[model samples]
Target: MEQLARLEDLPTRYVADLTQKNLVPLWPSLRNVLPPLKPIPHTQAISWKFKDIKPLLIEAGELTPIEKAERRVLVLANPGHGLENMRATSVIYLGMQLLLPKEWAPAHRHTPNAVRLIVEGEKAYTTVEGEKCPMSHGDLILTPSGLWHEHGHDGDEPVIWLDVLDLPLVYYMEASYVEGGECQPVTNTGTKSRYGKGLVPTQHHIRAKNNYPMLRYPWAEAKQLLNDLAEAQSQGPIQVAYVNPETGEDCQKIIGYSAVMVRANETIQMSPCSAAQVFHVIEGQLELQIGTDTFNLEKADTACAPCFAQVDLINKSSEPCFIFIADEAPIQKKLDLYSVRERN
Candidate 1:
């Protein structure tokens, strides 16, 4: 393909007129926005080690109180898009939030959909839409868009969780904002008990009330499922998606979550897709290879890959490796831009 003409090729006076009149030619930048084969994503393959993040989070806790800081969090910003943007990928926002013992994060709701993957400690609970969901290592809790939620810790140790949100996309659309409110009266326990694997409350047939039927996915269940899948299948990566029990759709509308288990000393080559993806290790260790870049991720470590990048995950430990993944597939599919390329 021939190179497109540069803006500098035009006469100075003509360029000046175009700039003065706020009119610009498209030829000079056409190839940029419409690259020949694939999108040029700014998201980079980057990893944040929990060891490096934990101290900063502890310092953040000591520096700012819950009242002053509201929700004290250290963002895991990807440098490819610039650190100021505070995004892990093009659409996902990642943060390590800390809640000290006996602390309470005030109740508020925002337009951006959010989920919490509990990283450490216990007795920490997130109340979403009046349902109190307990936090445990590797558990996933949803605080979807427009739902009031807050955090409270009852344990003796500091509680930490990885917060994944679709804030970048929502903010880019100029639709992100939050409303503060007083503590909510605990109206219900987590809805996870009411539903089982391939089962839902019988009442759902009569009439569905809550937009989000389940607010929490216990890690124990997901882990067991992965083990079962590994035992049932002799080949392929063992994975399970977190979805709405009632509709069997992605749990949230914008971002999708899933758990992947890599057998001991196994390697899995993920299909190249158009949407950026984030991989977080929940247990064991793994080596993540994106294109030519590689990262060794340990428990609680997180990594992000750019769109359409070739990704390979290898279990570095003798024990099985469990991972949590977040991606923009839901929104991409909704926008009709989701695609997977076949390897030659």
Candidate 2:
């Protein structure tokens, strides 16, 4: 008891000394303010199975209305992070949202940039600032930060999509802002009428005066490009990043995206990067390796790799494996902290 008492008085003695010297020491706060190394990674390798989540999504659609639910979504929460808040990784947020037939997700806008990767359903689309951008399986739709956007489905089946955002990073920076948008729905024109079957017109005009000029990146054109690239090459995975059609830059300022296809029985080279990445399996099966851990992921399953973690992928299936990825490279690059090294 005497020794414990003496130890407890150390802080009081330090404070007295600090007051006399007009100096505030940080030794007492060192444990939290400065650790020997990174205390813990903000992300971990985790996967969510569509088979497990589909029923719950259907139940949510049946039980809740669009306006009441606000947005019917199941966030992909990382097990290594807090459960109270849903985050796919430390810097990124992901959610699987559902839009049933005739349902309209009301218009809204936020400061954190976002993208939607269509997972399932058909004849549904998201309208961003007066342009109706249709959604299909494997298509990517962009909603830049502070842009007004809303979702609606006129198809016979439910529309499901994986929503990716840098909300966690925005929240960390204390720059998060959100507001209700003008409650209006834009006419659906399916892009072809405006762009001529996925081809950008010579004199195309943008409605929203935002950073990114294009709102929709059609899967038809992107898939054909990937196919053409694969036909010309025979070795490694065919990968392409989604970019702004106008500037050829990243779709969002803080979020990055890529689509990769690995041939059957092939393995991807290991890469160590400074930006965390969340990957969703769009087709086939593959093994994801984060450091010493390995996970088998199938279609509609999501996986994460923390920043600076050595990672690689392997496709042991007979069919090609298609994966969609969201990266925090834009944020890192903006801060001049982005780097990648090949692991030998």
Highest TM-score: give the candidate number.
1
Candidate 1, 1-344: lDDT as tens digits: 79989999999999999999999999999988899999989999999999999999999999999999999999999999999999999899999999999999999999999999999999999998789999999999999999999999999999999999999999999999999999999988684666765357675474358778878999999999999989999899899999988788999999999999999989999999998999999999999999999999999999999998999999867899999999999999999999999854
* Model 1 spans > 4 angstroms off: 201-204
lDDT of 1 at 341: 96
The regions of model 2 sitting more than 4 angstroms off are 1-40, 185-190, 193-209, 342-344
Each candidate: what lDDT?
A: 0.93, 0.81
N/CA/C clash count, model 1: 0
Model 1 lDDT at residue 16: 94
Whose lDDT is greatest here? Answer: 1
